[model samples]
Target chain A: MRKFFVLLAGMVLFLASSLTFIYVKGENDSVNDLLSANVDALADNESSGGLDANYHRIDSKCEVFVSAGMQIDIFGIGIITAKADGKIAIDGKVVCQSKGNETCRPVECSDLYSVILHGGER
Target chain B: MRKFPYFSFVLSLVVISCVSQTKNEPNVQGISVDINKQADISEFVSSFDGYVCLETYEECLVNEIRKLKMVGDTIYVADDTKITMFSRRDGSYLGKIHKHGRGPGEYITLTDFDVFDSRLYVLSNVDREIIMYNASGDVLRIINTGEGFSNLSVIDEDNIWLYSSDSNDSMYNFILIGPDADVKAKYDKFSKNQSYTIEDITFCGSVSDTLYVSQYYDNIVYSLHYDGYVPLYRFDMNLRNTVSQEELSATPLSELHKTYKYKESFRSIMHIDRNRHTLFAETWCFLDGLALKTCFVKADMVTGKSHFYICGYDVDERFPLFDLSDVIGYDGKVLISYLTAFSAKKHGKKYKIGNLADISEYDNPVIVFHTLNY
Candidate 1:
């Protein structure tokens, strides 16, 4: 009886561990999918190119590559790729790749991030 | 021992199911407002008579009038950068209260301001301080509210109520501060753990002794009392067609616009006047395409006889002088400001504002005050 009880306890622990692992892995996968989907949506925009003189609208049919220390305002739907050494500014503040260095920071402003994520739907 | 594992698993499943069921249910309960029909402005507003014209060309060059409040004859106006005082009787500039610097008694960004008892309280976003000034534009005393607050309103001479974005586990959305800048109370009557973005849709207004607060996403409007926040009214604009918060969160940020492209969303409660028992709100609904539908709701608190008017007309058809951008309630009157140039050219003959041929596009706005018929 003692041996049977010990076996049951071990099985229960293993099952719980497996369930937790699966749940966590599933959550992580969903998060990655969300982020990748956002990136693809932004890249799908046709108007992506060098900084337009208008300062508001960047008119281009190709991918807009922003180098470090360059400030560009994106209007409508435009995909921007920041170089490893390039930085980008959004809404008057330097956001990504500042000072010739790439720093990863979480975007706090939901409205600003929504504009970037949605490719300027508004 | 063998049955113990099976029993525990069954119990856990029951608990999980109960929790999920409770979460899916609507947590709020209050009066419902169903917008079944639309009415013209004249049908609901009784009359749309203009009381004052604020066209102080250069004296009060309001670059962008963010907020306006009238106390007696002093009209406090918060423009894009600074707060300017003007005479309500005449469109003359009284004085300006812009100490734009990083020094003491100065502010980097003027977020909001309120005038009470001849004292002006200016809340600076960057400085995280409430700079108080007397009627003469002299700095009184600065109250440093250690953290950044999004909105503020003076409850009385000694107490100030402020809204701060809280990501912490705390459920409170507002903090009442004393004269010495000490937190007097923290109160909220809603489900906790709401996203930080909810703050953008939150607005607070006080009329008489009751403090009215509401989140645009939520249908309920809460009034802060001495005890706590009580659900005063609920607006049911038929948001059943809108995207649920659960679905919104599950969807990717990038796909939000596409998935909910045609979904109608409740934007914000623009103005609330308790004395007149009136509330104005702006909602975004897809009409031909995306468009704003302004709702002017009036409810009799005692009788509960409510009526709403939907102001969704072209610039020419609607009251040309009243833009839904900003509405202020003061001294039992509703004040609306319009860009004089736009109104003058759009419906010059219809509205009958004399000779705007010389009014440039850069001129100050024309303030229109309308008396509410109770």
Candidate 2:
């Protein structure tokens, strides 16, 4: 029984170590790939989140409704506001000026054409 | 020695789960996605407007159903075989016109072969030439494209559109055929891009006197407007909303998956959006995707802005399109026909053909608009 226990312990240790090695190797490989792909180096993780404006309009007024508590890539939190009203949530929490688009109100189908968000010029 | 069946239990669970998942999918280069949950407009098509297999005739051994056009009662298909002519009412084979190739009267491979003004025009892969034929399949004449040839479409009896793509890319557009095939019209200026080449040129709507083109490569679809401004619709393939690549890859362990750098960055848009100004698309791709997964996207292309949501079709997970001619759209509908890897059921029984490659198995599917608000 003691011998068996020892063998089991060795097996567990081996698996744990192997898994750790693979995971770390995967992370390194992935990071290298990411760097090679983007001609520009990785910007600071905390770099000012800029809005990659995917949508456009004839005039400047546009509204985006993202799910609450979702992490949005968007930055510039304080000065901007949505056309709709909802719990301003971000990062899985109801946040105040949540610094991202996902924390904003949930957009409804009624807001299809677009809501007149006050300003996103920041 | 506390080990009874603990490791065995966990390992069994993992192996069994992995095997079952692999059984449902195709072995592909890219990732596997939740294709079943993806939007399928097939249910939205009117039953009469959907595909009805020609039960009485032999199926064409064509590799693709390139460029479908419906004129009056006839359904014209430029396929791997002879140009197929069928009756629209019950999918009856009317005739297969024109031998394809470059040797004397033959065409190498037919791409976007069509009939206009009772004249048959074919784009040949063999000759890299355009050959014309009368209705009786006689060689009318291999029109002298004074410049190097690409692909051609009938602009009129005397005018043809010759499109060119990157040399590496099998697709071509910027059609400069007809009387314009000569050097003065600028037909031979195209060269392959070092990093990427033109795959194919899809015909967007011609506004007044100008025509629009869309170029597909990697995951990005560039909207080319030689005469007007066009909106570029980028579908970043790696953008994660609610699901992560870990989650998606975890769902299917039998396959290797990679999340792209962005969502909406890479995708193919062809029959999906016929009009550049309109916001509908039926896109398909094989790799640079999760493998054999095709998507139908609805894009709103108004005010030079494009927004689209895409989902995978052909859940069996095969290459999207090996040749540019794999998918088609006509009259507000799209058709995706390929060899399927999964056993598609017909009358409740699975056919012997498994996966999307067996073009012989199931009927070609059409996407009916579930949302046609515009």
Model 1, residue A60: distance off in Å is 27
Per-residue alpha-carbon lDDT of model 1 for A1-122, expressed as tens digits?
99999999999999999999999999999999999888776776435632222111100011122222333334432333332211122221112211111122333323232223322211
Model 2 stretches with alpha carbons more than 4 Å out = A1-122, B1-48, B55-67, B101-103, B146-150, B168-175, B187-201, B204-210, B218-265, B272-278, B285-289, B300-327, B333-374
Taking the tens digit of each residue's C-alpha lDDT, what string does model 2 give over B1-374?
46858988989999997897566432312222332244433322223223334323345433345456666666666655577666667666676675753468786556457567767787754355677787667878776543333345566666666554432132233544444345223322333311111224355434333444444433333333333233444443433333332443243211111232122223344543434455554554433223223354444444533333233222221211211112344544334332221112221123222232333454543212122323
lDDT of each: 0.55, 0.41
**Each prediction's TM-score against the native?**
0.62, 0.47
**Candidate 1's fnat?**
0.00
lDDT (10s digit) by residue, model 1, range B147-175: 55557888787888877543223345677
Interface RMSD for each candidate model? 17.8, 21.1
What's model 1's TM-score? Answer: 0.62
lDDT assessment of candidate 2: 0.41
Candidate 1: where is the Cα deviation over 4 Å? A1-122, B1-36, B55-59, B167-171, B189-204, B243-262, B274-290, B299-306, B315-320, B323-331, B355-358
- Candidate 2 lDDT at B81 equals 51
Candidate 2 residue B347 Cα shift, in angstroms, is 6.9
